[model samples]
Target: MMQFHDAAKTNRSSGKVARPRLLAAATWAGTVLVLSACGGGGGGDAAPAASAQVPVTLGTAGPGDAQNHLPLAVGHSWQFEGTITEGANSSPTSTTVTIPSTRDVGGATALVLRESVVAGGQTTVIEEALVKDANGVAVLAAADDVLSKALVPYWELRFPLTAGAPFVQLDKTGLDFGEDLDGDGRNELVSLYSSVQVVGVESVTVPFGTFPTAVHVRRVLELTVRRSSDGLAFDATETGDAWFAPSVGWVQRKSELVGMGEKLSSLERLTAYTPGSLGSAGASQGATSTTGSTLATEPAWRRVLRASASAR
Candidate 1:
């Protein structure tokens, strides 16, 4: 039997009220948009020599903490090939997420990130900022408008990761989305719930190479959008899995959404990546930053495209 965790709608941060609530789908709510693209690649691609080593062996897939397992550096970039699956239809997808630069926000030095998705002869790009302090990595607001207040910053990854450990990322959060749908010139209310956990360590092989000690993480997102004015309601749920290698960043990811009266899925396999120096690259800098950040907190909503690049 499949066990479904009761995703609660509690605020994970300080409780503050916004004059007008906004829908997060435009930004962070995107974590669940693509899930059903299906394809298969059983071939192995050659990768560069193992010149890189896991700096901190705290959780050597053996003993250590996962706080530093993910490396985010400025100028760091990764391109992924995704496949989306619908009832008898499948399509290929390509996307890239990069840290453009770094900036100061609320006393925390954050990284500027942009993710571009191309599929179905169209392109959609989303930009967000994030920072990893003692609390973990969180996505910030793009502007100073009601968004920063209406929508809470989305947390991409959490810390102290241990095998078989579980934690809720976002509580049952309810807010009114400022976007107008149905061409009725009215915003709708969206209820959101999400959570992530470190499943364990495993050896996974991808186009990049074989990682013997990759951390397996899983996430689930559920939302309900309601328009009290027109009596419209939609319910959706998205689940995702990702493998992260220490010193390296995200090696691969898979996501699926099975609600909202539709099926959408996506897979992100690292095709090519250059983990630059680890701070957070904002602009063009010759030096590499010393930390890690994600390309898109939400790369959902798009057709799937497939392409492979020779491993470097």
Candidate 2:
């Protein structure tokens, strides 16, 4: 997986330009764009109305409550189409996030959301492996690019949430990050600092449809990378914004790195969503794939991207 905050095109002393990639971060490290932020005026289009009813409440919540109106349940899934733009080139990809199953984490049952993205003729997971429990939602581990080994966990968010509230950051800095960047056995150290802030209710338009009363969340991260092969280190910052609809989870998000001169940005928007059917009350279990999976596997995304990639 690429770093949601990785450099667009690194300038190598040996005259090599790194490939442009739209990646994911253990924590989102981005700077907010002039794009539609909550409470901003003259946005050209009127913000959508608050029609998306909250699956849960919109205000303060406790441990067992759904934070930011996010509905976490087995079988629940969201499909998104991602467009990553660098300079004048852009790459479109598809992703599906589903709660494959549950496991014991921190002594509590955690809903594991598997995020699979197909790129470069391969389907790979983000490696963060989102898990939710009574405490709240947690984003664990770095991407395969950052930590091919040691998993760095972050208790991203806790309950008792409210508008204009500060986020609960689990891990501020991670060290000794291991990943094979150039297929070499040795790489570098990746350290990160992440924070998320709620900007209250707002409306946003996405591919799926128009969502009203979308909970806007902003995330910022600072990454310090140290090379093991050489005594070299660099720091970069990133920012991203996500809109979550009640009961619908995340509807859209825009991610980009700070100080990037070009249009090196990635936009992901929801295309479809379905509530959990496996274990939710009043909802009968739906038919699953032969593998007992709720959503179509990687082959689906592969076909879509391949067809389009071939067309181009």
Please report the candidate that would top TM-score against the real structure: 1
The C-alpha RMSD in Å for every predicted model, in order, reads 14.5, 13.8
TM-score against native, each model: 0.67, 0.61
lDDT of 1 by residue, 66-105 (tens): 4355566577888888886655678888878777677655
Best candidate, lDDT-wise? Answer: 1
What is candidate 2's lDDT per residue for 194-311, written digit by digit as tens? 4567777788888899977787777664444433343233444456678777667778877664332333467888999887864333122233312222222321211221222221
Q: Model 1 off-target regions past 4 Å?
A: 1-67, 142-149, 182-185, 278-312
- Pairs that collide in candidate 2 are 2-23, 4-23, 29-221, 29-238, 29-239, 30-238, 30-239, 31-239, 61-160
* TM-score of structure candidate 1: 0.67
Lowest lDDT sum, 10 consecutive residues, model 1, at: 302-311
Estimate candidate 2's alpha-carbon lDDT, on a 0 to 1 scale.
0.47
